[model samples]
Target: MFHLLLVIIYLAFISLGLPDGLLGAAWPSMYQEFQVPVSYAGIISMIIAGGTIVSSLQSDRLTLRFGPGRVTAVSVAMTAAALFGFSVTRSFLPLCFWAVPYGLGAGSVDAALNNYVALHYASRHMSWLHCMWGVGASAGPYIMGYVLSGGGIWNTGYRCIGLLQIALTAILFLSLPLWRDRPGNGRDSATRQEEGGGAGDPAPAVPLSLMQIIAIPGAREVMVTFFCYCALEQTAGLWAASYLALHEGVSTEAAAFFASLFFIGITAGRAASGFLTLRFNDTQMIRLGLALILAGILIFFLPLGGNAALAGLIIIGLGCAPVYPCVIHSTPALFGADRSQAIIGVQMASAYVGTCLMPPLFGLLANHISISLFPFYLFVILVLMFLMHERLLKKTRR
Candidate 1:
């Protein structure tokens, strides 16, 4: 039953990722059909991000009240409905409306699942579960591409993913019993253990407010570290192709293809990191990842030719693979398991904040200054992330 539960969680993660790449892939067709400017996509994206931030901030409350299993099932259903809404929407306004539930569902499920796995699973499983997310993210674009290539509309692509999410939602609902049957099913039990109470000595689960969570030692540092890490990752992913084309003088088509190497590296690297976690702990894995990111950035900084730049992107992606999962996996240890859910929820919100803000900020710089500043921008964020992570380790040290 535990193994079956794990399988369901993995599928949930995949479902969580499926819609993430859909808008980016289908935006071109979507904009034209709706008679909106390409820039309108950003508006829709911002709406989604805003909704996600709100829901992520509420995740701890919801998860505590309903349990992760129920939260997961409901969240996936919400996302499925949002996707189906996207499939039938003809105007840009309805798309924006659908983005609300889309983001809300995404944020809740992401926080709930990450916290649940961090509490119940090994570091290796955390890494591999995220690898599953990367797989889904990668597949989303391909599925959309296939539909477009086959003369099917972008709506059909959305409908396909929506159907998949509905199926996963059903599985999740059926697996609620598994979640309940697991030991430490409720926050009260988990909090009791964290408080050093034996199973026989029941204790209340005191909820941590956002202010209380932030007041915890190492909490602010870890949150900032998450912000920096996500900022670097999203900025790099968003602008890599443009940087290659504009600054490195790669052809448009080639640059686009090369940019994909970043995500490919992340997916493959997470798979490898799952195995590596057996030997190295989370802190060591994080350090190694940070070092590789630094190295990758330096390579990008040098005039080592276009091929070297491509290699740097791949290396950067590889570096990114371990950092996110390791950070999440370490949350229960760094903070207490009792506080992990609230902390992880805030971390997810912080990550989305970075994702929503940084790329566009870099776009501004690239427009006014130079796209050549891309590597420098990444370096700045990476250095901050490294320093904060080290500080977090020191503060949390027993």
Candidate 2:
């Protein structure tokens, strides 16, 4: 049953990722059909991000009240409905409306499941589970592309993923019993025992207010670290092609294909990191990832040309693969398991905040200054993240 639950959780993560790439892949066709400017997609994205932030902030309370299984099931169902809504929308307005639930569903489930796995599972499982997400994210664009190439509308692509989400939602609901039947359940009793609690002691993990969570030692540092990590990741993913085309003089088509190497590296790297976690701990994995990111950035600085930029992006993606999962997996240890849910909730919100803000900020800078500043921008964020992780280590150790 425990393994079954793990399988279900993996499927849930995949569902969580399925919609992420859909919009970006379909937006070109969508905008033309709706007669909207290409920029309107950003508005929908912002709406979704706003909803994600709000729901992520609420995840601790919701998960505590309903349990992760219920939260996961309900959130997946919400996204399914939202995707279905998107499938039938003709105008841009309805798409924006649907983005609300789409975002809300993603945030709560992300926080709930990450915290759940962090408390209940090994670091390797965390890495593997995120690898599943990358698989789903990669598959989403392919599905959309296939639909478009097959003469089906973008709406058909949305409908296809919506159907998949609905199926996963049903599986999650049926597996709710598995969640409760597990020995540890929500807050692992063994963990509490290790923390000096008796076997029969009541669970100490009450939902914490945002302020209360922030007051914990190392909480601020971890949040800033998450923000910085996400800022760098999203900014790079968003602008890599443009930077290659504009600054490196790569052709637009070639740059677009090369940019995909970043995500491919992340997906493949996570698969490898899962195995590596058997030897290296979370902190070690994070340090290795950060070091690779630094090396990748340095490669970008070398006067090697467009090919070097492509190589740098791939290396950077490989570096990113371990950092997110390791940090999330370490949350229960760095903070107490009792506080992990709330802390992870805030961490997700901070990540989404960075996702929403950073790419656009870089766009503005690129417009006024130069796209060549991309590596410099990533370097600053990477340095801040590295410093924050070091600070987090000290604070948690003390």
Each model's C-alpha lDDT? 0.90, 0.90
Residues 38-93 of candidate 1: C-alpha lDDT, one tens digit per residue: 99999989999998888888888887667778888999999999999999999999
Show pairs that collide, candidate 1: none
The window of 10 residues in a row where model 2 has the poorest summed lDDT is 188-197
**Segments in model 2 whose C-alpha atoms lie over 4 Å from true places:** 181-205
- Per lDDT, the best of the predicted structures is 2
**TM-scores for every predicted model:** 0.95, 0.95
Model 2: how far residue 204 lies from native, Å: 7.6
lDDT score, candidate 1, position 79: 95
* Distance from true location, Cα of 215 in model 1, Å: 0.9
Please report how far candidate 1 places residue 58 from its true position, in Å. Answer: 1.0
Model 1: lowest-lDDT 10 consecutive positions:
188-197
RMSD of 1: 3.1
